[model samples]
Target: MREKLGKISNFLVSLAAGIASFVFTLVAVLVVTDFNEKLAASLIMGLFALLIVWVASEQPNSSQARAVSALIKRLLAVGSGDLTSPTPAAVRREMPALAAAVDNLFEQVRSNLDNVHAIALYDPVTSLPNRVHFKREADRVLKARGWDDGVALLFIDLDGFKEVNDSLGHAQGDQVLTMVANRLRIVVKAETREDSLAPPLLARLAGDEFTLLFPRVREPAEAERIAQSALVALCEPFEVGEQTIDMGASIGVALSPRHGTDLAALMKAADIAMYHAKESGRSQASMFHARMAAAFEEKVQTEKALREALGRSEFELAYQPQLDARSGVVVAGEALIRWNHPYDGLRLPDSFIGIAEESSLIVDIGDWVIDGVAATAARWHARGMAQRLTFNVSPKQIERADFFDRLRAAVERHQAPLRMLELEITETLVMKCGDRVIAELAALRAEGLSIAIDDFGSGYSNLARLKDMPLDRVKLDRSLTADVDRSEGALAIVTAVIHLIHGVGCEVVGEGVERREQLDLLRAVGCDVVQGFAFSEALAETEFLDWVRDNAPLRLLPRSA
Candidate 1:
């Protein structure tokens, strides 16, 4: 207490002495000058006022106060992005507690900044750069490369990822994604290091999409080699939990100056090329070309048109007769979708169905078809028509958890023609469907909705899986019967398939029986039903009903007549 009082007393005395000296000096200066009497008086008064204000407001009373003032000035440097400035030693020595607190505050700020940066620029799940970070780095690399050097961008998309998610669940899907990112990093790192090239920038763009930037590659072959390595790395199965998942990637390569020198253009080209690789059969790489952009634009336009198609009511259904092999009576009419495009005239499903599925428009389109077919069946049943009506189902439609509910509602809304409605799905879909989907199909079947396998022999013929499904009929693919009348091998295979299907307690329907010989062959092989041009091409609703009424006893006769 005495020491503090003595210090304060001494400070006051010194301050008084300093003030007295400043006054004396100013008076001495005015006397020495003896010039400009009014100016000298004004200067003395101003000097005295400044001294008083300095002592009262600005001057620090002790070393601790001075240190704190200096420390605050230094800390405020943070506003200018100068977080790394060191604290003065004198300040540290004078007030260690405040110095330590400031240091801790700076540390917390830095840690928080790092976290924000990671969240902004890195994918949390894979810890790879996110889309924003990828684009920033890619732009930097492209700019640094200039016109002399060439760079390549690889846009990679995973194949069969949706199936993995649908069948195994999203948790397993995330595991697969993380493993994929790690494998890609390893492969890319290894290749770049082995070749002693500049390290490539890799990032997860979004779900199942990743990007790799090669900053120093000039040759397409080099990029191709890297893409192949990445593909081969992904070819190794990812073992997640009890499941060993086999996944593949399609990589698209776009070179700077060739595709485009900018980030947006390069990315667009690479994305288009990647889709081409995927469409041309996955597990490969495709280089960007001008033609791909055109096709991509066309597809974009088509997708846009398709989106408005349902709202515009531009879609309609045509029915083709499915006949009993012995009677040739129209047992069912396969409902096929037609787009009465205003500008393009009548368009087949082939013109837009692929786009519809890719853009997820199939779900809505599928719903529309279901409603249309149900209404048609109800109308036909009201008119005393006994034949069933069938329509194809898309995999995307079945992927929905509420597919059964929606379908049942549609049927009931149309007075419940569950007995006259048959749903056809591809054989591959039937085989690949998850247990939940299979159960739903069984539930629908139990509700008296017949399930038929469409294009049965088109893909992997897993008859065992087929038997496990609650299916009532299997329709042979057109390919299977394309030459069944001429080729003994085809006939034998068809006969075996029919018998196998029959063995599973499912009736066999032969598709594309356009010739009498084919019909005769199918019938001889014990095929229960046939449908093709041999009966009639798909007809409009009214035409179909008229044909059905006129040819109710339509006999199994050759089209040659």
Candidate 2:
């Protein structure tokens, strides 16, 4: 095109010059020759001078037109995807100035296209692949035998996201989400192998929801390991702005061709596994299993029933007397929780304590135990029975923020003296969060309530910790006391524990003292209290009160050695 235009322009210029030269020559000839010689001679000299000047000026125009034509050709070639064109040396001086601008324009166009595509395929906030693009790519890969060997899909949902959002506001919640997304990305990238047929893809499906697709997993174990890694990654605290928030994710895993063959089925299986993870306990990962579905459903029903049980007041307390070893008199009674399930008859703590602990319903159950025991103690005081009342406290109850306040209210409501109430905590509870538990125990002690370390020797028993704790008594665990007479080792340990506890200014209570030899051993060891079937099993409130009345210490003579 540039060549054709150049030809047309040159021809027009040549024609104009040719016409002028011809006219000038004709006039020169007419003057120089016999026909008007003076006029012709003057015209010929003027024409020759003009021709020289015109030729010199016209040469630059032709050269300029040729340069422009070459430049136009180079530009057209570049635009048409023919980058092999050698830059015309003749036009380099001028064209080089425009070359960089053209190159930059092309670069800008490419960059803009890349940005547009990125926005379409990724979540703006997290920069994780969005569901739309993930599904599209996954489907393409699946169709092309991308997952022929093995692939695992994990669907992760944040367990306590709603609680965080509700307590901290949406801004903090969003920051947490972003942190979680970053963590997921790092975990997936680290676990995925570079040489694998297909690498893992991480996507944020929606609010507090993320998905990971691990293509070309070496084995099922590999998928499980990756899921576990994801769980561990989420275990750390997320620093969002100034606040440090902790959140956990429940991951559900489904392996392709095993759990399902397609995206929808695999996602469903993963969802089921996720529900199982939540049901078993949040903050864990679970693989798809058919049995887990039924178990998950049962847990839902059980939670609902428990909530209903609370509302219907289908709970009661049973009393177990702690006997003074010397006089065989009841020194105190321990209150035991029993759930009077309407259909299941009566259920013990072993059946419901776990459920209660998980759902935080133990707080209410703990409150009920306190109130009932306080009322029992008040009744005994009114009847002139000067004995203390003891109730067991689980770690959950002791850790509750309102524990002390609730206990105070129960004591006040029933007019029970703090000195006559004892709180029994397990050794494990005290050791789990040692400093805080010790401080809380001290506070309770200062309020005039007695504290006993229950189930001693079963947990991580640090003698130093026990001595430092504000405990009034120590109850030897049943395992140590059960075969005291038969096992010399058991007898020695029991004797040592009793002497040690007494030396620390704390009384010793021997639990599960069923046999005569056990009671005799406990007595010899100087145990202050003995509680078990040796006297009577944990009894109903009425049976206990009746036994208390019949076995009044005043009626029994002191035993002689």
Residue 2, candidate 2: how far off, in angstroms? 26
**Per-residue error at 311 for model 1, in Å?**
1.8
- Number of the top TM-score candidate: 1
Alpha carbon lDDT of each predicted model: 0.87, 0.81
lDDT by residue (190-235, candidate 1, tens digit) is 8674442356899999999999988777888988888888899988
Prediction-by-prediction clash tally: 0, 2
* Per-model TM values vs. the true structure: 0.87, 0.60
The alpha-carbon lDDT assigned to residue 33 of candidate 2 equals: 56
- Winning model by lDDT: 1
